[model samples]
Target chain A: MDRVAVIGASMTKFGQRESWVMDLLAEAGEACLDDAGVAPDEVEHLYVSNMASGEFEGQTGIMNALAHDLDAMPAYSQRVDQTSSSGGAGIYAAWQSVASGASEMTLLVGGEKMTHQTTGEATDVIASITHPVEYKHGVTLPSFAGLTARHYLERYDAPRESLAKVAVKNHRNGLDNPHAQFRKEVDVETVMESPIVADPLRLYDFCPITDGSAALMFCPESVAEQYTDDYAVVTGVAGATDTQVVHEREDPTVMGGVVDSGEQAFEMAGLEPEDVDVAELHDMFTILEFLQMEGLGFAEPGRAWERVEAGETEMDGELPINTSGGLKSKGHPLGASGVAQGYEIYAQLVGEAGDRQVDADVGLACNVGGFGNCVITTIMEAAE
Target chain B: MDRVAVIGASMTKFGQRESWVMDLLAEAGEACLDDAGVAPDEVEHLYVSNMASGEFEGQTGIMNALAHDLDAMPAYSQRVDQTSSSGGAGIYAAWQSVASGASEMTLLVGGEKMTHQTTGEATDVIASITHPVEYKHGVTLPSFAGLTARHYLERYDAPRESLAKVAVKNHRNGLDNPHAQFRKEVDVETVMESPIVADPLRLYDFCPITDGSAALMFCPESVAEQYTDDYAVVTGVAGATDTQVVHEREDPTVMGGVVDSGEQAFEMAGLEPEDVDVAELHDMFTILEFLQMEGLGFAEPGRAWERVEAGETEMDGELPINTSGGLKSKGHPLGASGVAQGYEIYAQLVGEAGDRQVDADVGLACNVGGFGNCVITTIMEAAE
Candidate 1:
């Protein structure tokens, strides 16, 4: 079977942006096309991964608007929505399009515009993805995070200071990523002392509401050879869903979706956790990083906090994670977060991450949606 | 290359229902799973085609809820949205999942809960798909239909009665469908005398806002053979998009998306328009039937009205269209409408349509989104 290759990638600054979703999508799409030296007319499939352009901006069918803006008229277009994992789902969709012979050149743009709405309104939209029975009573994602963090600390006897370290490390990484939202570094003291929104978690423990976009260009490996050799091949990609009702989980610490998707992706790549040299895990909340790390098999249950405290996931350490700062400081723009994760791995694989560069041959990205209601895991490698 | 085969299909009654979107989707999904004689655990991929559950019912993450409701745990799930063509887009996505070897079995459910909202609210949600520039000025889909109907009649010299005949014909066909929203036959006189909605068009000319769901089960030909002997193979499936700005179209009479997607699908099927034995056209409005017929190559430019007048499109005619009453008398549930179109064609090909079945070797369904801003055409054939 032929491999799907990502020949180009681009992303806008992951912070407050004045442009609407369509413009954000078009900006990244055009940059990706230019990066690959491919004409707009060559794109056979155009997919936009957007969660709630309708609810947020009163705009639907932005996929058509994007194709029109990019002069990719007559190209097949659709919107892939998997909540915050939309970008990872877009990658899987693009790979399917190329691998299935349905499209020769596929362009995937994932974006969202949310800063314009007040924080309360924006969080309300984000909260809507939770199970209605839970969300209707004001159980937002932050509440879930706080509850889960408290449980994890009690169950595993992990220190709260370890959670604060995640923020500090990611912020340090973000200082080097020009496109990140927060470019300034913070200390453990700062994150630990931040205003407490939820007990045991503070303002600095969560990703901020952001507006941005990201894109990737995909084609068959043979076709990608014509574009450039500095490309990354997505060796494995898979997604999975767990119970929608979060309370039903036998163990909240064990995200079933993450475990399943990660195992599937690694098996497809013919690799294991030990084989991955670099990684990017969803850090929507500081505690999520620990959960995903444990869920994806980087560490044993109740031991991920130990790894974080050991400096193993740092830039110069073994199996560096979130070299693009993850969502902690890089920003989480719902739909764009997962795509940006892919961009980080793609850049690391292609040796284009000048300042944030880390030695990497195999890379993985784990994107969690709606507190692990769904998750997608993708593994990429350098195309030789 | 192995073919992707649809082994089972089902749909709920297309009418006002008290169930929410999740219930409607699960109703169709469970029925489809049972029809295929497959256990929920066997479904590796589950897709939901929903346009605006959040905007309509303040519900999101429907795909996850559906997976949980159907007991299809750990299966990868995603939501596909292409406005009104969401179901067709879901079909394409499911096919890709199977053909790409991403899944051994895939289930797709397309649905929307709209009757709960007032017509003004429902239409407002639907109109969000149109370009903001036009919709901001109080221009909605019906306004476009009226203006286009007037232009089509004046430009092609087609009679207004020909449009009325569409409503008459579909209503007559709906009389035979047990699950149709409207089962009573109507005469051309009744349609002509209906209250004027958009100038030349009348109230009867538009499909009612409905609440319903439809589903299909797909797998590889090898896998499908183990499940069922009677099945339909999707020979060709393609989608395309035109300008988002409706006025920018070179000619309002020519639906570029319809023509392109139809041609692409036919070519992929190694067939032509003339080879199609039956079809289900998107008749969101009466005039759309004429435009689609002409766009799909059933008639020459400006001659679809003549074919309708000649009775060639009736159930007993040379190439029967809308045997499931299309979206006219059968009801249009936004996302479900396209899936229902596929269901009609699949039923006819598999000898299961009962009263509305036609002698079909090959069938096609054309789904239009946002006034032809995007379209999907799917061609299917009986699996021997």
Candidate 2:
């Protein structure tokens, strides 16, 4: 199999956007195309990830709209939606297509327009990310997160203060990320005092539903070599699923997909956990960060919270995770979260992540699509 | 690279359903496992496709729910969505994963539950498949199809009844399709007289918003070798994206991704258009059949309607298309439509299509996701 590389990547400042989804996608996509120094016409294929355009903006078939908006005539585009992990899946799909010699250059774009709908409407839109049976029984994402958080507390004997540490770390990191939505730093007290949406999962424990977009330019290793002397080589990519309905999982903490994806990705990259210098784990909910840290093999089982509370996941710590603020502080524009994770990793590995720069040669991104149903973990190295 | 083959496949009868999405997914998945003669324990990876649960059923993270339901602890599952073509893309993703040596045995499943919502509610749910900008302008699937149908009629100077011919052919073929949603015969007059949802596109011309599912089990040829003497070998798999917004295309009839997929699939298969004995084209709308025929290079530009009127694509005809009634008569449950298309081709290639079986050594399936945004086509042949 041929190696697929991320030659160029970009993201619009992740935040509440008054612009249309197409505009956000275009800005991000154009940034990627121009950054790669590739002419727009050189792009052979496009993938767009938008989770709930119809409810948020009453729009659909967004790929075509973006193409027309971007003047990418005759170029192909597809929209990928696996909720929050859509961006990661888009990259995975594009990588596979490029690896197979299907296209010379592929653009993976993800964004959402959440502000178009009122807060109540947007909340309802986000609620769709839950299991219908479980959701109909009044289970919101917060409620689900609460269950997971409760389980983690039960399993690991971790204090709620550990969860507060995650928010403090990511928010502090966000202060330096121009593309992050929430740049304001907060202390553990702020997180602990925030309104509780569900037991144990406070407002600060959840990522805000902000509108944003991120884009990545993918090419075969050969094409990538021509595109740039320095790039993020996708050494490994893997995606796995557990179940759509949360209740069906025998062990919610198992997060089988994340574990599987991480193992497979590490195998493909020919690297071990110790090789990763930086990490971007999906933190849609504060508890998700703890779960991912453990499931992704970065921390010992039930040990992520302990490590997090000790600032082991902070910028100066070993295995620094989510230096870009993560979904918790960077904003969770569902489809864009996963892709945004990639954008941050690429920046960090390329030494372009100015303030939050970690001395990193290898970076990994773990994003879960709609809970743990679809989880993808990709490992990238500084271009050889 | 490892070769991927279909070891098992099954689907729920397409139509309105009282069952929940999990129930439907479980039923279809269980049946697929049984058909493949493999236990759920034998599967290593899972991919589930569903377009909308939040709006239609207020569900999210369906994979997590289903994983618990299946009692396949430690096995991984992931959710994927690419509009109506989700199922096809899901299968393609699984195949690529297996080929890339990620997993030996993978299960791909897709389903939807729209009957739970009212027709108006369902319309809003289905309309999510359109471009967000266009959708806000009150655009719908039928409206989009109407525009395409008009363009086809004016561009090709084909009779309006030519549109009817597509439904007539598929419905006639559906009569022999036990799993078809509409298996009754209808004449051109009856189709022409059907109530118009959008001008020039009638109710009969549209695929119903369905609650159904289809599943396929994929394994490397090495592993599948032990399963059965005869199986459907995935000779070629290709996916490409087109403009998601309909109005953005320079020529709406010309699908870049569909054409690209066709080219790549044919090249990978070491075959040409003429080598296909039968095909299952994406006919989400009547005009889509004509466009896909042209896109697949099965017919000259603007001549698919003429070919259809000549009965060249009928069962036992020169090129049988949609012997499983395509999406028109076969219920289309967004994500399931693509996988269902793959299942049909698998059945046809293995000579298990029952009464609708065509004498063919090779079969093809073309599934389009959300208008023309993403398209995945696969060419298959029976194992020797």
Considering summed lDDT, which 10 consecutive residues are worst modelled in model 2 chain B? B71-80
Q: By lDDT, who's the top model here? A: 1
| Strongest candidate by DockQ | 1
lDDT of 1 by residue, A224-340 (tens): 999898999999999999999999999989899999999999999999999998999999999999998999899999999999999999999897989998898999999998899
Q: Tell me how much of the true interface, by contacts, candidate 2 captures.
A: 0.41
Report the C-alpha lDDT of model 1 over B1-384, residue by residue, as the tens digit.
Answer: 899999999999999998999989999999999899989999999999989998998888888889999999899999999999999999999999999999999999999999988999888888998889999898899988999999999998989999988888899899888779999888888888989999989999999999999999999999989988899999999999999999999898899999999999999999989999999999999989989999999999889999999999999999998999878899999889889998899899999999888899999999999999999999999997
Of the true interface contacts, each candidate retains a share of: 0.88, 0.41
Please list the residue runs of candidate 1 whose C-alpha ends up more than 4 Å from where it truly belongs after superposition.
none
Q: Candidate 2, B163: how far from true, in Å?
A: 4.1
Residue-wise lDDT of candidate 2 within B260-285, one digit each (tens)? 88898898999999999999988888
DockQ of each: 0.90, 0.37
On residues A252-349, what C-alpha lDDT tens digit does candidate 2 reach at each position?
Answer: 77787888889988998899998999999888888888788888787888888888877788999998889999888899888888888999999988
Return the lDDT, model 1, position A69: 95
Q: Which stretches of candidate 2 lie over 4 Å from their true place?
A: A73-76, A116-121, A132-139, A143-162, A192-203, A242-258, A301-306, A369-374, B72-76, B116-120, B128-139, B143-163, B192-206, B241-258, B369-373
- Per-chain TM-score of chain A in candidate 1 equals 0.99
